[model samples]
Target chain A: DVKVTQSSRYLVKRTGEKVFLECVQDMDHENMFWYRQDPGLGLRLIYFSYDVKMKEKGDIPEGYSVSREKKERFSLILESASTNQTSMYLCASSDRGPQETQYFGPGTRLLVL
Target chain B: QQQVKQSPQSLIVQKGGISIINCAYENTAFDYFPWYQQFPGKGPALLIAIRPDVSEKKEGRFTISFNKSAKQFSLHIMDSQPGDSATYFCAASYYGQNFVFGPGTRLSVLP
Candidate 1:
């Protein structure tokens, strides 16, 4: 079975603070993605990395950045957290194939106050 | 722009009844379609998937019906149970592009 683990299941941060969400996958997939899940809006991609040091902006990339220094780890960074940034963040990894299934981590519920 | 559109934002089905969710995509390049189920406080999990070449694929009580010409696909849950209640998302992607997910459907299976 494929395992995708997130650094935190829940997090609390103050406004204007920096926040980091980490994810690790054991499947050695080549594609890693960061998304924020919101009610009614569904899952919107924030950023994705196809390979180490290669990143692409998804539909909702503002106020967020990503790091992929290694194949197994991907990190999401928030420069200045705000109340509006509070959301459930999800990380996923997929193999390098057209139809490969993307396995997702449990997710981190972030609360900014 | 929402590339994929899903209908019935919420659904309630009784046990032993059928639960159906529909999704439509605008991109013809999209060849792979997958459905994901997300429980409360949990991440979305891949439930079943279908390709354009096949009209339907079934796994247990979960079935995916595909219509290539209409650019649409749907998920049918037979004998709905309380455990089947979750948020279902339909995603579309091409060979090399990232997936575009639909708005999602919240299903509640009444026991």
Candidate 2:
């Protein structure tokens, strides 16, 4: 079984603060993704990394960035957290191809006050 | 480009009843359709998936019905139980690409 771990399950930050959400996968999957889930909006992709040091912007990447310094770890960074950034953030990792099934972490519920 | 529209923002079903959620896609290029189930404060997990080549696929109590011509697909949960209550999402993706998820339908299985 794939084990995806998030650094924090719950977090609260003040406005304009820099926030980091970390994700680690034990399966050494080559593809990792960051998504923010909000009520009524479902899951929207924020960023994705295909390989180490490789990153791509998803549909809603504004105010969000990603880092993939290693294969097992992917981190999402909020340059300046705002109240609107409060939401559940999910991290998922999949093997080589995009068609492969993704294993998701429990998710981090971030509250930007 | 890639958009998936889902209906029934919320649904309620009695135990042992049938639960259905539908979704339609505008991008004909998408070949993979998948359904995900999410519990509160948790990430969505893949429940079942189907390819355009197949019209239907079943796993346990979960089934996926696909219609290529209509560009639509649906998820059916048979013998629904209270434990089945969750948010379900339908998604479509082309081969080896990012999936576009629907708005999602929250289902409540009352016992």
* Each model's fraction of native contacts: 0.50, 0.46
The residue-by-residue lDDT of candidate 1 on A1-113, one tens digit each, is 98999999999999999999999999888999999998867898999999999999998999999999999999999999989999999999888766766778999999999
lDDT tens readout by residue for model 2, A1-113: 88999999999999999999999999978889999998877888999988999999998999998999999999999999999999999999877653466778999999999
Separate clash counts for every candidate: 0, 0
Lowest summed lDDT window (length 10), candidate 2 chain A: A94-103
Error of 2 at A31 (Å): 1.6
Runs of candidate 1 with Cα error greater than 4 angstroms are none
> Fnat for model 2?
0.46
- Number of the top lDDT candidate: 1
Top model number, TM-score: 1
Q: In candidate 1, how many Å is residue B21 off?
A: 0.5
Q: Each prediction's Cα RMSD?
A: 1.3, 1.5
Worst lDDT window (10 residues) for model 1 chain B?
A: B92-101
Q: lDDT per prediction?
A: 0.91, 0.90
